[model samples]
Target: MVQELMLTLQALGLPRPVRGTLASQLVREFHGKVSELLPSLPPESMQPLLSSPLDASQWEALESLSQSLTEQYCCRRCLLLKRLDLTTSAFHWGDRAEGQGEAMKAVLFPIRGLLTPESDVSVAHVLAARADLSRLVPATSVAARQGTSCAINKVLMGDVPDRGGRPDALEAAMPAWQSRREDGGRGKAGPQRWGRRKKKKK
Candidate 1:
């Protein structure tokens, strides 16, 4: 089938290109079978990424792609990510978000090839939802603390005292206690007496 196709192309423009056409045909077939990678990560490993403060995945993908593209035939790895069939690279963890970003600008088109229209839309939607959620939720402990904890108009507890003071002796002591004229100046427990003193005639 390929020979006939190559022969036809030769008649028009590829008279000397047998190998290049055959290679192209093989690549097309290969991509069809390989376009199933989806960049799978272990639940344990993915947990940290999910818990991370940053919601952006593009940065992670770009970082990974940056290192991968410096190697030979980088498209293989990228295609694997795009297809979502991460079974190929089981332990191949990376900052894929960053790598993918860098790959988009690479001449090899490695990034674009893996990211299809549907996947792009899905990613954008997820990032948008994340951003929306981020606004609704507090980003830090301090931010969460700043929110009101109660809906009541007034505090149930009385106003907190700014400074501490000792209770007055009159308030703390009983009415039965009597303070002598001299005892008043000296804050000592006055002698307790039930009746007044009687005057003795000389």
Candidate 2:
């Protein structure tokens, strides 16, 4: 059958000038199988130019072809976080809304692949979903603290006073208790009697 296939391939303009070695014969057979698989593809696509003991041009062509394929095959659409429902462990895409067209298309959640540990999703899954690691890397504690400090500094710089400092502008605006404290706790009680002691009841 292989001999017949080879003869057929030769009839279709494939070169077989020499009765080659077993290795060469196997290569030709493999090429023939590939040609059968992709009958409509150009000669360049089916060229095994990068077979072991290759040439410089073949190496260059292989690299260029690989890069071209990579560019063509790269995924165009990416998942962007729109609304995250932590309670339900689900998230919606930017364009999807809760009552939009189909319920399945509106939200997505991690599905357990199988009943095996190997199939469980991990941090790697999250890493893979991140478009840019530099942007996705979490804010450091020090950075968070610095931001908080800046916010506090801005607040301190405003009309609000520090803990121990008195606000002169707020003296009249003080609470009743604070005013009473300043006035020796006077007006809070009823009038005091002067030296009149009541007589003993008969």
Which residue window of length 10 is worst by lDDT in model 1? 41-50
Model 1's TM-score against the true structure: 0.12
RMSD of 2: 22.8
Cα misplacement distance, residue 179 of candidate 1 (Å): 99
- Please give, for residues 1-202, the per-residue lDDT of candidate 2 as tens digits: 5665576667566655366557677567767866676767644453332235657896677567656654544422111121223423443343554555355443333332211222233323332342232344345667566665554455444476557645664456555553434455555666887997889999
Tell me the lDDT of candidate 2. Answer: 0.49
Query: What stretches of model 2 exceed 4 Å from their correct place?
Result: 1-52, 75-202
Clashing residue pairs for model 2: none
- Please provide, for model 1 over 147-171, each residue's C-alpha lDDT reduced to its tens digit, 9 standing for 90 to 100: 7544673648878766746565335
List candidate 1 segments past 4 Å from native. 1-84, 87-93, 96-202
RMSD vs true structure, all candidates = 26.8, 22.8
